[model samples]
Target: MIVGVTGGIGSGKSTVVNFFLELGNIAFYHADIEAKNIINSSVKVKTKIEAFFGKEAYKDNVLNKKYISNIVFHNPESLKQLNAIVHPEVKKHFKNFVNQHKNKEYILYENAILFETKSHHTCDFIISVYCDLKTRISRIKNRDNISENAILDRINNQWKEDKKLLQSNYLITNFAQIETKNQVNHIHNILTKKRKLI
Candidate 1:
């Protein structure tokens, strides 16, 4: 089984994925990290990004994230172009990952843009992690040292939480006030049982 886990910025999706990892049977593929790696390592991706964004897109063969982020967040067309270049490669990488983990009962494909990139179609189940907007803003502010407006811009760029919830097979609320571990364990047990019947 392939479970696609997603959440908006600062929704604690990584923490939830960690809890799922603690259960000891699931293989995990983090798409965001893989996307970064692909952009840095894949010649096709590098050429396309540079062609679109110019040489400033990278610094000494490494991605200039600040440069890229500035362009994408403020310009929807640029963001769409960037996604167009990167997502297909990320999807290919994910398929290779899933194939390698086929022996596992299930695997977790954690992505921030699962729905936007249409990767959810590859999932047997989708788990969305949600949290209040205020909490999300505060967490990102502290973690990314980003301004409130910038964080809000990034958040606004993604699908809204309520809309994402409608598409989810399961929802994990990751508010600080709630015990997320129990929720993860509950879902983990359910997934394990479901995998057996497959």
Candidate 2:
């Protein structure tokens, strides 16, 4: 089964994904990493990005993330155009990943914008990680070393918790390590019990 685990920016989704990694029962595919790889490796995508955002999209053969981010965050149309280019490439990459791991008992696709991008529809089930906005902002600041305003901009672009909650099969609220682990275990138990995999 393909289980999509998603959450907004700074929502502790990675922490939960790590817990599942420790269980050694599933393979995890992080979409952002794949998207970066696609952008850097695919000449077609690179050309398209440069055409849309200008040569400033890349510097020294590396993605100039800040330059592109500033444009997208400040304009909805730019963000939509960028997503249009990136999302298709990422989807094709994910399809290849799933094909390669067809024998795994379960696979986990972890992404920050799964719901917003409609990527969750490809999965058999989904888990939504959540936390309060204040906590999320604090986590982002500590993890990414970015200003609060930058974090807020990313958060504002994500699907709201209420919207994601409606589509997810499971919800995990992360506040602390202990609570996060407990939630992971709860979901693990449900998956095993329901599938009779235990």
Candidate 2 clashes: the total is 0
Model 2 C-alpha lDDT per residue in residues 10-61, reported as the tens digit of each score: 8888899999878756878999898889888889989999999999999998
Candidate 1 lDDT over residue span 1-198, tens digit each = 999999999999999998889886789999999999999999999999999999999999999999999999999899999999999999888888888998887999999989998889999999999988989998998999989999988998899888899999999999753489999889999989999899
Query: Candidate 1 — worst ten consecutive residues by lDDT sum?
Result: 175-184
How accurate locally, in lDDT, is each candidate? 0.92, 0.87
Give stretches of model 2 more than 4 Å off: 196-198
lDDT of 1: 0.92
Error of 1 at 162 (Å): 0.9
Colliding pairs, model 1: none
Clashes per model (N, Cα, C within 3 A): 0, 0
